[model samples]
Target: MLHIVNKSPQERPSLDACLRIAESGSILLIEDAVYAAVKGSASAGKLAEAAKKHRIYVLLPDVEARAIADRLVDGVTGIDYGGFVDLVADHRACQSWL
Candidate 1:
């Protein structure tokens, strides 16, 4: 299943939602959600680690806005805008956390 989130790691249980539902082949992170990818974000790292440990396919974008786009850690695949839209379309269900 695909879960496209666009919130920072600390707001309104976005991380909690991810932890509760993310499984193998789950897609995560979008827009502001990418903040979690930055270093020093515990929930983000934990989520990524858990996804990897479970072989879940976690994805994020590489666009830079408020900060440089290099904050996303290893293991999370970065896709282009078209791919992102395709992912959202292919996923079917969506829970907007932004």
Candidate 2:
């Protein structure tokens, strides 16, 4: 399963809710949700822990747009638009946390 979140952790609880309910799968952070992948951010530690059970991905373009490319967490992977399409195709299903 692919759990997609596009909200900022600082502004919304969508990421937290998804993390709590998703047991094992992939997580793709798009839009403002890319903020969660930044090092030293409030949600970084939680995201790091989640990475143990879930393959964490962040949209490269989104991260670049936010100018947070250099601060991404250790285990978080960055993907381009094509990679995003591949992820959706690879997963059997996806849930978007709006």
Model number with the top TM-score = 2
TM-score of 2: 0.98
TM-score of each: 0.71, 0.98
Q: Residue-wise lDDT of candidate 2 within 1-98, one digit each (tens)?
A: 99999999999999999999997999999999999998998998999899999999999999999999999999988999999999999999999999
Compare the candidates by lDDT and give the number of the best one.
Answer: 2
Q: Per-residue alpha-carbon lDDT of model 1 for 66-87, expressed as tens digits? A: 4636665666666777776777
| Model 1 misplaced stretches (Cα beyond 4 Å) | 53-62
Model 1 TM-score relative to the real fold: 0.71
The lDDT for every candidate, in the order shown, is 0.62, 0.96
Candidate 2 positional error at 89, Å:
0.4
Candidate 1: lDDT of 98? 48
C-alpha lDDT of candidate 1 relative to the true structure? 0.62
